[model samples]
Target chain A: MNKILSTVVLMALVVVGCVRQDESVIRIGAAGPMTGDQSKMGIDLRNGVELAVSEWNEKGGVLGKKIQLVPGDDQADPKQAVSIANKFINQKVAAVVGHWNSNCSINASTYYHTANIVAISPASTNPRLTQQGYKTIFRVCGTDDQQGGVAAEFVLKTLKPKRLAIVHDNTTYGKGLADFFKQVIENKVQVVYYDGIQTKDPDYKAVLTLIKEKKPDVYFFGGVYPEAGRLVRQAKEVGMAIPMVTGDGVYDPTFISIAGNAAEGTYVTFGKDPSGLPTSKAFNEKYTAKFGAPGPYSVYAYDAANIILTAMQKTGTTEGTAVAAYITKNSFPGAFGDISFDKNGDVTKAPYVVWKVTDGKFVEMK
Target chain B: MFTQQLINGLALGAVYALIALGYTMVYGILQLINFAHGEVYMLGAYLGIIVLGVLTYWGLTAYSLVLSLLVTVIVSMAFCAAYGAVIERVAYRPLRNAATLTPLISAVGMSIVLQNFVMLAQGKEYKNMPPKLPTEGFNLLGANVSPVQIFILTASILMMVALQLFVAKTRLGKAMRATSQDRVMAGLVGININQVISTTFMIGSSLAAVAGVMVTLYYGVVHFSMGYSAGLKAFTAAVLGGIGSIPGAMLGGFMLGLIENFGASYLSSAYKDAFAFLVLIITLILRPSGLFGQKAMDKV
Candidate 1:
């Protein structure tokens, strides 16, 4: 009787193990911060990927096999992202669409590269990500250099402040972007104050107080929305009244909500606002119908998903090597516009536009 | 410029002092560095935010900001005090006579558990308090000092004074002092050592809660993980002040705040956190007993 029970348990284990990877479906992984501070962005990315996959599956699937999206929640953490990458590798996913934060993508891509699994990030923009020269890594968004350069040009050509201050959260993304911005503006503009702040620091009075002494006309904060909002609010409290500029990290409406009245007149550098774009019309309509409204990265996530699916279709296989090769050779017409990759697997023409927050909305400035 | 930076340093130091007192007090009593003490402060800030958020949602913020802050402080203090007592009863009490490493491990475990618990309950995002406080400030020597800074400084001093009086003037305080000197002897001399220890944890945690609330308001945001950095700095302050000395902890906290703010202002902002640790290293090298700490002679 014990031998019979053991045989039954072994069969059960086999059945459970085989359930995830069925022969009829091709698995692709979607990893992001499904729950946490960045859950909205993660959920938006997952929705976009799922929507793209479902649309493809409805149209007779990709390469005569149903596309299945395996979702993993990395919680926007670097360590968790690496674990998720390992999980995707174990599941034998052909490609992964993920890692909204740059540091997560930078860390997780190392594992994906080792496993030869193609990873296309939707939102990470740290310059070092592409500079690492990994064949398995690709991003559909602009790097900090591109975004920060555009911001610096806009500041120098348009706003043209005599003195400027650069502040960052001291993380890889924040500091990297600030450094990029500084590199462009340092020669033209009189750079007065530059500082790095703790990410979760509640107060910015000390830093703002020092900036007040410097009295910079333009203050660029190279951090995400939460910290940027605090800086704006606290800067106003300290009576600094300077115009603040930031990267695409503050494109969300949450920044305005957090900073309230202080968010007005603040400038943010975004790659492109896909909502009003002619190409994104149908995608935006369908996205709003399903998920109320697409987030800042939803179109990028959709484009990322589409680019991977397109590569798979062109190559006629779910194999990572063939798909990545196809991706490198071909250009994708996406919601953001024509997306092409250079030798570094970075988008060749990652155009950036500046937008100023006017009455709680990002209005593009020409 | 100098005056502005000095005021900034003092304001930052005041919050650090409140948190350091908790570490110093617990260390004074048990000699067990309660690593979980930081989480208590983090939870206190969360409670303050939650209470304020609920009150604001109910349209009570229009009633009065001062009243709302008072309610937040009281509620946060009560909840944190109970939590401190319970943590002592459960995590620390069980391993009372165990190996030294055992309770330390338990404390670390407790810290992680508390952090995750709060993270699960309140989503792991930076919760921002609306711009409720009056942003107006008075100018002193060309430096703007906000009412919030004045309040933080005043309240911290008041609490420190109250704690000093409680420790030095009351019978419970005497019992606490005696228990810390020798727990077994204090127990034989009709002092409830366990009760003294619980009271010590409660007081320490309550002070930390007040600091947590002040920091939440001062920074205008709070996150579940905020405790780790604040706790680390406060612990450093406690050690800098003389780990087991209350006054030493207060001085250490101020010194750390001043060093960090001044270092960030004068030297480089990237090394703001490093300045505190640098001073701590230098102080330990030169005077191992800390600035205000008495030299601890080998008892045996």
Candidate 2:
């Protein structure tokens, strides 16, 4: 009786595992911060995936099978994200649309690569995410190096500040972006001050005071909105009236609310606003109508999801390795325009644009 | 430039001093590090933000920003005092007679609970205080000193003075000092040990609350995790001054702020936090009892 029970359980386990990858369904995992301070962005990314998957399934499904989205909340933490990636691997997902944070994505990338699972990020913009030579990892957004270079060129050409001060919040994303910005503008401008502040530091006056003495013409901050907002407000309080610039991290509406009037005239660099693109107008309308209003990376999330599904459909198989290769070989029309991954799995020709905060909202500068 | 940096250091140091006093006082009384003290500081900040948010919604913010701030400070202090007292009762009281590590672990557990509670109550996002503090300032030796900085310095000093007087001149303060010196003996001497411990936590929490309000005004933003770094720095300050000495904590906080700002300005700002620890290690090596700590003799 014991031998019969053991053999029956073994057969049941194998059958249950195989049930998930049946030809009737294709599963894609979406991992991001669904419960922490960055939940807003995570929700937007999830909603984007949902919209894309629903639209794809509506168009007679992919290879005569409905696509299923499995969302995992990593809370924007590296360790948690790795566990989420492991869970997706256990479930044998065909592809993953994930990891809103650069650090989180980087942490989970190795796991996905080792498992031969194709992963695409909607918003992890750090260049190192692709530079690590992971064939299975891809992103729909421009890297910090590209965005930082555009920002530096604009600051040098338009603002033409003689003395520049650079500040970073000491995160992988923040420091990487600032370093890239410095590398591009070091020869052209005098970077009189360079400093790193703690992520949640409540005061920047001391650092701002030091920067004030040097009389920098512009201050470049490479950090997210929370710290960036405080830095801008405190810099104003310290009476340093120079123009402050930051990367895409501070492009959130909350930045304006936190910095108040101090955010006005602040220069920011990000991928050109997809909502305003002619190709994305219909998607943006549909997104806003469905989920209130889409976040900064929602369009990119839609593109990432569409890229993965289109690859699966074009390859006519849910095999992860083949689909990942197909993604690189063909260009797909996405909400942001033509999407193709380069050798490093980075989106090809991901353009950056300058934006200025006028009144209260971000207005793209020509 | 040097003078301006010095002024900046002083202002930043004052905020650290405000927080360090709470850690020193709790350690003095119970011999417990009270790791949960950081959560109390976080709660104080959220309280301040909530009170200000409600006032702004009611249109009372435009009535008088200074008066509104005064109200915020009081409400935050009162709420934090109760919270600190309750934390001691629920978490620390049970572990009081247990092994030393027990209460320390309990404090850590309570800190996590309080952090999650606040995160749930007031969303995990950073809350910004409206730009109410006046940005105008006078040049002091070519350094820009804003009114908010002056207010922080003046208010912190005043609170420290009042605290000193309370500890030195009052009967309750004497009971607290007695309990710190000899808890069993003080209990035998008719002093209510529980009441004294509660008062110590209350006072310490109120001071932390004031620091929270000052930081919120100074930074114009508050977040759930702000306490961790601030609390770490303040705890470092307390140790540098003398773990259980009030004056030592104050001096240590100022020294840390000055050292950090000067180091960042002159040396590398990337190693700013490292400089504080380096000074701490060097100072402790020379004087294990801290700059103001009394040498304790092992009883035979």
Interface RMSD of each: 2.5, 2.2
Candidate 1, residues A1-366, lDDT tens digits: the string is 999999999999998998846788888889888875667778889999988998899998898999999998998788999999998888888899988889889999898888888899998999889778788799999999989999999999888899999999887889999999999989999988887987656667778888988889999999888789888988998888888999988888878877878889999999767777899998988888888788888888889999999888988887777788888888999996788998788999888999999987889887
- For candidate 1, the lDDT comes to 0.87
Best by DockQ: 2
Task: List ranges where model 2 is wrong by over 4 Å.
Answer: A1-27, A34-39, A53-84, B53-66, B295-300
TM-scores for every candidate against the unseen true structure: 0.90, 0.90
lDDT tens digits, residues B1-300, model 2?
Answer: 788788878888988898899999988888888888988888888888788888888877799877888899999999999998999999999889988788888988998888788778887777877666678888887777777788889989999999999999999989989998999999999999999999999999998999888877777777776777888999999989988899999999999999988887787776788889999999888888788987641210
Q: CA lDDT of B51 in candidate 1?
A: 87
lDDT of each: 0.87, 0.87
DockQ, cand. 1: 0.37
